[model samples]
Target: MNQQWRLDDGQQTLVLAARSGRLPECVYWGAPLPVTEDLVALHAAYALDVTGGMLDENPDLSLCPQSARSFPGQPGLVLRCTDEIRMLYGLCFVDAQQNGPDLRLSYRDAAAGIDLTFSFTTDPQTHVITCQTTLNTDRPVQVDWLAAPVLPAPQLSDEMIDVSGRWCGEFQLIRTPWSAGLRMREARTGRSGHEHFPGLIVPNRGTTNCQGEAYAFHYGWSGGHRMLAEELPDGRRQVQFGHATNTQAAGTQFQTAPLYITYSNTGLNGCAVAFQRHVRDRIVTDAHPVRPVHYNCWEAVYFDHKLPELQDIATRAAALGAERFVLDDGWFGLRDDDTSSLGDWTVDARKYPHGLTPLIDHIHSLGMSFGLWFEPEMVNESSALYRAHPDWVLGPMDQIRGRQQLVLNMASADVRDYLYDRIAAILSAYDIGYIKWDHNRLLPAPDAAQTHGTYALLDRLRADFPQVEIETCASGGGRIDFGILKHTQRVWLSDSNDALERLRIQHDAALFLPASVTGSHVGPRHCHTSGRTIDISMRAWVAAQRHMGFEMDPRELTDHEAKVLTDVTAWWKANRDWMMRADILRLDSADPAVIAEQQLAQCGSRFVVFAGKAATSAQIQPRPMRLTGLDPAATYCINVINRDHTPGLSRGNPALKSGPLTLSGAYLMHHGVTLPWHFPETMWVLEGTRK
Candidate 1:
């Protein structure tokens, strides 16, 4: 079961060769290698090889590669998987250099798929190995690239290792002070995937002889990677890998996870590698602990809401007990609408007057945190940035005939520096707490001149600000990919904020991301994207079960509306602890209206059930139920936070007062909780403690 892959850096282009003779290998030119059977020449088998570019003649070409040809070697690259986890593992390929470090092998675990690529460099004097696992997402993704301090000996774990399953792994070589890690992505297509590989190091983290960088994480629906760069104390620099994600599958219905390994260079001849905990089988929800429910002023202000108006919203938001207040768009430049304002990042003097300070101060005055919006990766033709840095924008430097209004080239060093400084300055100017950094566009058609430069630019920003949080948005959902999640704290589930749309969107979004990392907000119906009027109650019900929040103008809502919000948010705050710490048990949603529910177990003694009504019609009702999975003698209280136009209802009134609900398999099977025939949007938190 010795499976592996390799790469060869010759006089021509870099060549990547896979281990198996059966599986065809791919070679990436200026653009990605073609996976589909193509009508083109470079991507097809036995076509013209893209050689040259190695002497560093700009290294930019449509098809200038030496060529990475793969055929079975004398003894084929040995590959195997240690676990039957249906995970991808084993050696994928290796790249040999002329005189420098030669052997480069790639390994990946399905548990921690390839969110990052591994790089290893040697320390000159000691010959110690320094390894770093850098993310390849839209933002800076964090991954540790350190294994046990001792060298990897040729010993295998006694655990029954399986050769058929795929597993992901990372390694690195070190010289005297510098370290570089080798990351390998491998997977076996056979049926034996669950077996365990014991030779791998037991993952762990310890305070090392290294300084941590202050950087930010960014993510979206498309490509994502982590950047670990900093504008040093003295403004020098020390960059490492942030975090990265990858979608290993292809096509419309594909699959992926937040999987990657981290390596660190400890002293001695020792290095370390540990599996990161970013992968999951179901939707990741913010319903878990440590995440907060937030509110944003995008739909409310759209660019019309000035500082004072923003202050008004903030005042109410704080009163409503909102934890975070995000000032979306219009705050920057002369952005009157979505079309004209992008690319110009300066504050709109007409609206902001004394800059963003006043508004940020006002938000803090209300005892709430502040967030700002930035569409840094895009440029509008009307933007000052586009006019000033025309060469920095993507399109043919000769002619501005691209379909896009304009695109920022994040790959160039100057462009990357400009964005980093501009954003850092804005964030620093105000006591800004969060950023709704958006990319309203998708990855533009790659130009021979700027692909690597753009990628490098994004990587730099991510590594520069790891502590600040950013939300990834790509024209809503067009760019939502695992590659982007590695760097972002959370991603907007979709541009379509419709509750019904959100049900499926979030369901899909959660497939790889945790709920906390996915944003679900309640906004006005006739949603911004679809303009569909959905029940606000239904919206709340769906959004609350995840990392929940709202994005509408409170002014537009009636007093009843405000109260409904205040009530539901209160319910979230109350039972949030349960949602945070427990493994959610979702009821079968074969019926779309059944929506989603999660059972939160705080401890063996206490538990709570969070449920929502997703249907819009008043006549649709869920049947009554004798719930299962409960201690029969346990005392229970059901708290239903209803969102209909009910008169004079206050928080003190227990909507559905029931207690000590007994549980039996037959009773549970025969009865499901019944709701009002015409139930308004509502969420019920049923609480109990095991006796």
Candidate 2:
């Protein structure tokens, strides 16, 4: 006899409960309670009693955990049918609604005819919360697993950071610990797999990344996901994400990807500024609201194409400021590398016999903007669209071909209408705008309809090129998520262009990416995948920390590496429109060879720290570099914006290289920012403001 529900936005609060009307549970998520709290005495004080061999009825770890009620763990629905195995017992509750800030809910089972629902919403300007689940059955069945609406793990989290990596090391933050049963993590190599990167975070237990308490999830599916967390043997804990248990195929509606949770009491950079402002203001879209300065030419002339050597490397990447160029992977078919012309999206004409319109009119006469590189779910059986569709190739035909290509069934609608008429005839024949879109390999199986046919061909080329902008390269950071950032706009986070390992994979992928959809590049002072030489000022301030670019070979730099890559690409084009709407944070480093961050500014009146030492510091002059979110009674005016990267082994006088230091944001976040004796791949760069 219970029933509760809650949902608020300003920072957090979720609630949810159920008892007699069964299946519901997320009993009290954190922070913000009291618009008159007392959700049925907070679900009977979030129940938990019957000890000694448990089960005197404590199974409501509900929200779908049911195996006819003796609930244990990992059972959020797992149906079956082709001759037995189904157990969705007594799933009660049949309605609850709201629909504005969303809140749905509805359950059924009706003697296993199924039904389930659950929606949830919340954003209040990116505090982020989104959940989902759906089932609907009646007859056909198979869904071997469903979940995406389980939530409830914080037993003061002893550890959980998840998000592993491979292929030039994508993201990489693992952590683990919180024991006593099931920790699971799956991906099944089907895009979103440079070894599982769907995302999770936990924290709580003296959390850090500048404060305490955390909790973050993110399974926005791009095929084959599985997460879990668990604990319960009565200690109660749960997590669960879905889509990878059976890869579903005999069904009557089944849904799950849209988890995206969030909750942070100012640490883990408040769930990294609410999943980077809900993915740069609500899940990317047709992009180009300023974020340019790029330049790709695949490590300069990879297949050795030469239209006057890419118009002299696009006039030295537009005299070092760039602003967009792209053209990676030998520009198409008969492609001289990565095993032949993938899916032949034309445009090669024997390496542009005057076709990519003279390199898109010399990169639009160097004012830039041109990008192009496609893989479009592979194919290359020596090309010409796998010799005219070898049965539209997907899964088996004697599988086993990743870089030699194959997977192009995108759940065929005649192969998404012949790869959307050959990628809309090269985005309607050139003057492209942008599109890196690569995927590189892995997936001889694990198809959630080939990620819904590559999100129906990137949502039909974003509704017929609403000003083209795509960018989600998989062989690098293997298909990053928020489910392909809802059809693309930057993320090629790593293919090891190694700037001291992209400054620790952009400092632990800023705990869930943000540097405006992170891409960062500036390779080739000998870093063709970690042959690590690094120094063009630590590779242009670690590619000016994200979204900035230049994948090596701007004629192999060196006029002092082309004036330090033209003064850090002119200070990332003069603070890239408020550092691409800042808030990266991550700083608490009393030197583990420092790998700082602190972008700030979203009306916190300007900031920027950087810090980066990356090796050699077990106590040796240079520490106090902390700073996060600011404003402890203001007064900043910092400076030290790269005191010419300082080295020559310390002739000490570290008032951060003498100059500008008004301090006090509680003395630079509890006395930090001293740093001066550099070496071991340095990278400082400060720049406060708010006096």
Candidate 3:
């Protein structure tokens, strides 16, 4: 006997079936289909045969629910009972219940005294489903492996797309053929390291930005995670994601992370739009009140914290329209470089004889908020805290140091209390508005306890100081996921400030993350990482679309550069609200050297589009960039926001005439505006409002 269930959120549908009293197996999970009570008939209609030639001899040789079943390959649940028994056999379904948009299925093994429950929830607006499983046992059970949200893929998906890169270059796209076998991408570095971001994109062959079918999955975890894409021998593909758990006692019950999945027939862009909408609506509700333009004093005057020098720099920053000024990395204890004084949180008496009050007061007077950088989870051996409690550090007594610092044993209650108190004291003493939370190293092993402790620490801080905003920075672009987003308002996408390289990183990072949550800063003319000198106009244009900031010193800018900064900041402030609340769209272009993106307001009354030239090509003629996500019947008036920075504006093309161009949304989206032939490292921004 077989039982089938289905869930639909108007746009998409998910179907599951159970055979011979076991957990439910995914039958059909894609676009909506007709409802019917006859699941057997539906299976036959799709011609899905689980039984092989020798069905009678090998009764267990059928495709079963890989989610929580006693299957031979990649068992979802690996259990060891108190009696030294390692197998969980003889499991049978108990009951199933549905409440609104949530479905819960329960299963039990009476002999083993184990109970398992799987939950499925659908967000009615985004159509993104979240799935998770929990296991509870009366007897002590040792759990080795557990998977969540095991998604079944259609047979047509043959290509997989994901991101992998190192420190300076993150989110580099990698594509490969999805063949018959298990392929897994994991991040076990105790952090979501710079490599292997926790998102997966699987689309059919030849899928482009705006066409073809695509599927996406993103794990809402910041610790060790694994994403699996497997194709069984029966031409059935499955995508599974969950937290990486080792041999741990299942005290009473254990629950996995919520794995999110979505499907789109309109291409990878549609899939990405779904994730953005889900995050904006469901994940982050209380967004930062003001996305202020920021300026950091790291690259400008590193470790040289003089009150008069910084005050002068702060004056220049305020003159350039910077609303926030961050003092980075040299204000605490006997710290001049990265080698010493990490754990100590007090202000260096020698640098600031009167504490930080004078500098903080000066910054406030300039109409800019003050932000300080701190690496709270790490301690240097030369610090006072390490000498007091050497046991607070993880690893051996003679530990191997990482970046001249040791990881604080956050799992320890004593350590958590000490760090919390230290941070709280700073918040109490000063008028700080923001904190650049930095994590410089990875944990030594797989320790979920540390991850939990970190979350607890941040949660406590948020509760205590509800007005302070936090930005998560793990080395750089190392700790980014929905898990960390719950606490922090923004993330440092990368340490490399090269505008050209940042174009690719920012473009791909925006696939799942919104532009407002990604921090993009303008660096020096000669970037530290890439050693490439980019024009200030180009760098400012790229940073305008994100949470705008500046890493370089404003005192070093020339007259032209200062004018560009003023213009860019003015444009960003005027358009940030729509950018924060708009639907993101990535336009497909035939030229690989060109990359275009647009943010369309929900009401279709306004939009902003950016087109960048990554490299110069031999072709002299430029491409006509078609726009998307507009009111088809409404007329729009378009104007260039950065008209002065756009080269060759005098050589107007046929599509764009003199004066402000006006056209119907339908005509503009179908027959786009033709761009002028621009050189490499040039970008243009177009602002359109309904007329």
Best-fitting candidate, measured by lDDT?
A: 2
Q: Write the per-residue lDDT of candidate 2 for residues 1-691, one digit (tens) a residue.
A: 6788899998889989887888878889989887988789888887876867666778778777887777877788878885767654677888999766889988887777888898989988888888899888888888788888988888987988888879898778889888889989888888778688888899899888889989999888778888888897767788888889888788788888899899998888899889988988888866887798888878877888888888898988889888788888877777888787788888778778778898788789878878788888878888877777788888778877777777788888888888889988888977687888888888876878889888988888889887888888888888888888888877888888878888898788787778977888888888877686877888788888878888878876768888888888898888888888887888888778878887888899888888878888887788677787888898888888778667777798877698887878988888877867888787888888997
lDDT-based ranking, best first?
2, 3, 1
The 10-residue segment with the lowest total lDDT in model 2: 82-91
On TM-score, the candidate that comes out on top is: 3
What tens-digit string does per-residue lDDT give for candidate 1 at 1-691? 1222222222111222322311222232111123342323333342233445323221111110111222111111111122322222222323323235332233322333432233433323222222322322222222122111111111111111111111111111111111232222211211001111111221122211111111111111133232222222221222222112221211111111222212222210011101112322222222123566688988887768666677888777766658888888777777777667576778888887788788877777777777778877778777788778788775465544322456776656787778778887776677766677666543444221232343354455556655567676654543344344444566665656677666645542332234556677888855776667776666776777677788877777767667766777787788666554443443443344544443435354555544555555333344563343444445444433342433333223323432335444344324554433334344455554443
Q: Judged by TM-score relative to the true structure, which candidate is superior, 1 or 3? A: 3
lDDT scores in order: 0.44, 0.83, 0.80
Model 3 worst lDDT run, 10 consecutive residues = 54-63
Q: Candidate 3: which stretches are off by over 4 Å?
A: 34-47, 50-72, 81-85, 245-250, 397-399, 648-657
TM-score of each prediction? 0.57, 0.41, 0.94
Clashes (backbone N, CA, C under 3 Å), per candidate, total: 141, 2, 0
What's the lDDT for residue 532 in model 3? Answer: 91
Could you tell me the TM-score of candidate 2? 0.41
In candidate 2, how many Å is residue 334 off? Answer: 6.3
Instruction: Itemize residue pairs with steric clashes in candidate 2.
Output: 558-561, 624-673
